[model samples]
Target chain A: MGEAPLSWPDGNDRVPYWIYTDQGNYERELEKIFYGPVWNYVGLECEIPNPGDFKRTQIGDQSIIVVRDAEGGVNALVNRCAHRGVKICEQDKGSFSEIMCPYHQWTYDLKGNLQGVPFHRGVKGNGGMPADFSMADNGLDVLKVHVRNGGIFATMSDKTPPFETYMGNRILGYYDRELDGRSLSLLGHSRQRIGANWKLMLENIKDTHHASLLHVFFVTFGLFRVDNDSRVEMDDTGLHTALSSIRGKQELNDGTAQMRSFDSNLALNDPSLLDVVREFDGDQTVVMQTLWPNVILQQQSNTLATRQIVPKGPNSFELHWTFFGYEDDDEEMTARRLRQANLMGPAGLVSMDDGQILERTQEGILAHPNEQGVVELGGRGTDDADHMVTEVALRAFYKGYRNVMGL
Target chain B: MTITPELRSEIADLANAYALAIDDGELDRWPRFFASDCLYKIIAKENFDSGLPLGLLMCDSQGMLQDRMEAFSKLNVFGPRSWRHMLGAVYTTGSEKEISARTNFVIFETLAGKDTHILCAGEYRDIIIREHGALKFRERLCVYDTTMIPNSIVRPI
Candidate 1:
């Protein structure tokens, strides 16, 4: 059978609505984009610090288990029994001696190697005559793991380049700045299921202009406005991006005066939420690094987190947010991070609007599947920008999407 | 001080009034339930059990509580919706200054034109103290069993 037809609107500016609504297109994305040669961000190495510690997570639509082996090495294994195809690992996170299937009693080691079978020599040799069942050949599907500093990324295809190469030199510089060799402590997590395409949230982070326009807290407080010193960057493939900005004062300036959302009278009743303890070696108060295919490393004020995108289907996805800080951070800094976190997550003062907008965005698009949304804020180009007023990153993302999906 | 019937009744009234203020969209009155300096956190039961210090909403002061309600009412953008909070039995114990209380909560949200559904199911763990003849929450920890949020908890649950 021939491939189902997928149409791409002319130029890099017009994004077709069908890309988000078509089930067939979504399945193609699962194959060509997620499970393809691209590197997918899984979790952090600090999460499973001890041997036998494991966490269940998703990449695309597949259930994956990231576990720490006895040798302190991390493994990303497909959470399916090799013999019976049972979905194992009920707990979201736990410590285990070995991975086991409760149904058939098929067992695997922490490294996902098949270690035991319920009846390898079935029924006291009555039915185990032709025993060519090889345990070595029946291990859980192991993903190629890349451990960088404390970040964990895995790939399904062997064609994936080295982690650094995949991130590119420019994006890697931005990544290392935040994930800088320091030991990290798991602060906590906020998991929410958003009724929008996974890519929409990625677009939200890469959207340099929306911070001030959509989030009143950002515009009124001058945390991320168009007037601030900000820039947008992209890698060679136009897949990876880093958006950074230096927070400005709350005073209404020429750039913010035009925003309808900005209200000068608004102020944080408790100013502690905006307390910025400059621990990182940079002046930028916020740096959102969006690694293609899965995650966004966020450094907003003192709060820090990694937002992982797990696509549920065509029009929905689960966002697993792991908030973290430096391991050696003082109690005050930790407190500051937690307090500042009120600005994000599901009920976050700023990010709460993002979920609503994305859901509405998809709803509106679903109403007219054949139509297209314009990504022409900056222009009809896909170049990095020194200003936030452009949608070049969004355009770049679609350009990469078009190439990967072969649309 | 001991667990008396009068004090238990007063605590129950406070809990009812608190939920009413939020469910009824009388958000301005939400902050009045707490002391001037307080700790109000809506935490996940999983995180609370693991002793992880994180919550969906963490307000450590009266000002922060006001900040949240103000954001919800004025700045934040969300779907037009209303919620009904059905609280379970309110249990209370007393001390010299602080009264410890716990109550189970189940909230059903009704978005405009949508079917009403359970938003979250949780238990409230509160430490109440009297300030100027009125009982107020000094530390209110809302640990929810439903960790996977439905879209977003727009109206504070």
Candidate 2:
């Protein structure tokens, strides 16, 4: 309590405002949570199918280049060049046989192995690199990468557990359900920069309380609601959460009468927007999972996507959406995936309200850095719940966060 | 079939009227600019160039457009704001049935108490046809170059 500026109260229900606003805490989060022994989502294997295909992305605030090598294997490398610390890959994505820092032309193979340095041999040995300078000793920083199904994740620390063990058993089931060993093809992407604490975005999906209340499209269309059959499950470490809900028809009863976002009169003129074709083996129409620290896997109807959260600062994050569908999907199925995509993303009918809400939440938190948010909706205990009326997953999330961050 | 000067003038008027409808805050009339069976999509240029079929907003029929505008006006929660849509010339090149037109556009948004900023910068690749006597958009593809949308896009661009 001496050097710490935050005065946290007991229990996971009390989330202090300082965690969202404090610069010191933010730095610690970057170190312990992001760069620490945790697997961070980089990109998908399908996004880089061909050898030499590469995509420049982020892990926390650090730039990462996820590339497929000539050997048809995926690799994750720090974007910074080993020579002059220059960002090697400037473009978002492209097919590159080799990487060269635009600043000095320091070259590297697709595996990020230092291939050549222009001045290393230096003009017929006049000003060359030292005799002991080895290319193997000076390669772009590599991260331990795990590519399973079609998804790709990387970890900076060696102490991080394997991908399967890290995700735990419960969360892995949900993760595999989406990927399912199917060949995935890229649909598209929509990016947004939100001015708010990054964790709020995670909490936003983890919290089912706002789904039926804040989104009119969700409530009016019966896509998700508290009354619907829903389940909230977390990983053993409580670092990941999956919220699944079966879509029910909207009815004007005691439940709908109490809500402000729902309107019986409001209906889609084109009902084809909700023309959901049952594909998965479950009755649940929505499965939104938060893969701690980075990505959110969204499976709302036929719209399948990964919302990658790249934290820019203490109070801001860049959300990168990678929309995809199975390669074997017929033209009609592809169209369905494309059509259903309107329900999420930046201009999503049901999701467009989220970025603004998070920014507003950040604004309020910045105003009152001493206050804390109440997470006692479902009680203090973090347990699996079969109902939507619970903040248990959030409490579990913070518990995992606090354990890793040592808050 | 022929490209007449009168037809060009009519197309220009249609484009201006479309911009004025939203800038004037008459979101109710937003869907009227399109034909009954239309395609109005707000897509990123990256995806467009890459042949990706996704969009920030994708509406196939006029009914879908109405649904989108309805969601924006009635239920979607966002700060009160206004836009100033600045458009360049609507270039027209066509066939005997419909005219294919493209125009560069930029929209600046200002919240009630905030300063004005560039909300989006993109080109509208459209297909124009006559619904009754007036020209209506059969397909309005808003391919925006702004990769990162500055917060939320509450209203359609």
Candidate number of the best DockQ = 2
List candidate 1 stretches off by more than 4 Å.
Answer: A1-5, B94-96
Tens digit of lDDT per residue, candidate 2, span A181-249? Answer: 999999999999999999999999999979889988899888988888999999988889999999987
**Candidate 2 local lDDT, residue A141:** 96
The ten-residue window of minimal lDDT in model 1 chain A covers A1-10
lDDT of each: 0.88, 0.89
Which pairs of residues collide in candidate 2? none
DockQ of each: 0.80, 0.87
lDDT of 2 at A252: 88
TM-score of chain A of each: 0.97, 0.97
The TM-score, computed over Cα atoms with residue i paired to residue i, of candidate 2 is: 0.98
Q: Top model by lDDT, which number?
A: 2
